[model samples]
Target: MQVVIGKAITYEQQRLIKIVQKQLSEIDKQHLKELYEVTRIKHEPKDFSINEVKREIECGKDIQSLFQLANTILPQLKISNESIKYYASLVGYYSVYKLK
Candidate 1:
């Protein structure tokens, strides 16, 4: 499904964006990278089961580590890239991270 991230962002939304981007960038797992790239290229949200996210984190990297990487990358998407919240919100919810 398509997510609308181009909606004007508020300051609180900016914080949320920063957190997710930071988390995404800190992730070190190959699978997480693969999943992220897939989502990016598709321009769609990823549909990963919690178990899958857990497995990718447990087997390759810690979930929080991946989240931290996300936090770093998310905000950059707005300025230097396309709005990834559409794709990222899927990852955030999949990873069970609360976005404010």
Candidate 2:
């Protein structure tokens, strides 16, 4: 029996996709003990900036939804959900620098 299945990634999922991409940029500068290139995520666009992800979060988006989104995007990239949220939270922490 062959069954075709596709996952419905939501708006929050899209936001997490952006968050994961932004987080990767900062982590890329650090010395990773593991070769993260093997863990690189492809579908999320590089153009989605931290500020953009922040906008999504600031627009009354819930954290639980964001976490669910994170699960979908980062699993393929081999990143854990906790690590994903920790990095995404930095978007709020470092938001001042993002303001021009």
Candidate 3:
């Protein structure tokens, strides 16, 4: 019975992780799209892939690592530290939701 309950809990956690991943992906897509639009309007579009950045974030990279990646791809765009923190927080949330 205990083994069955443990398996059930693990399964539920996996399900939640999938659901959260989907939701976070959608949110990141929308967020990146909006940022891209703004940058385009300013005639300073960065040559970066939103999907790639999202993948890196989802892979549990540290916030410093994210900033490093962002700096490499978006040197001209001044991304505030607060904004990085916000993105890091989202990654942290996703990580928590992905626990099994």
Q: Highest TM-score, which number?
A: 1
> Candidate 1 local accuracy as lDDT?
0.49
> Model 2 lDDT vs. the true structure?
0.47
Q: Residues 62-93, candidate 3, lDDT per residue (tens digit)?
A: 33443443554443334467865785555434
lDDT of each: 0.49, 0.47, 0.48
Better of 1 and 3 by lDDT: 1
Compared with the true structure, what per-residue lDDT tens digits does model 1 show for residues 1-100? 1234444446557876565555543324453654543332323324688866665555444345555665665555554344464655465455323221
RMSD of each: 11.9, 17.2, 15.5
User: What's the lDDT for residue 3 in model 2?
Assistant: 30
Q: lDDT per residue, candidate 2, 25-70, as tens digits? A: 4433232223222122212434669976665555434334434544
Off by over 4 Å in 1: 1-61, 79-83, 89-100
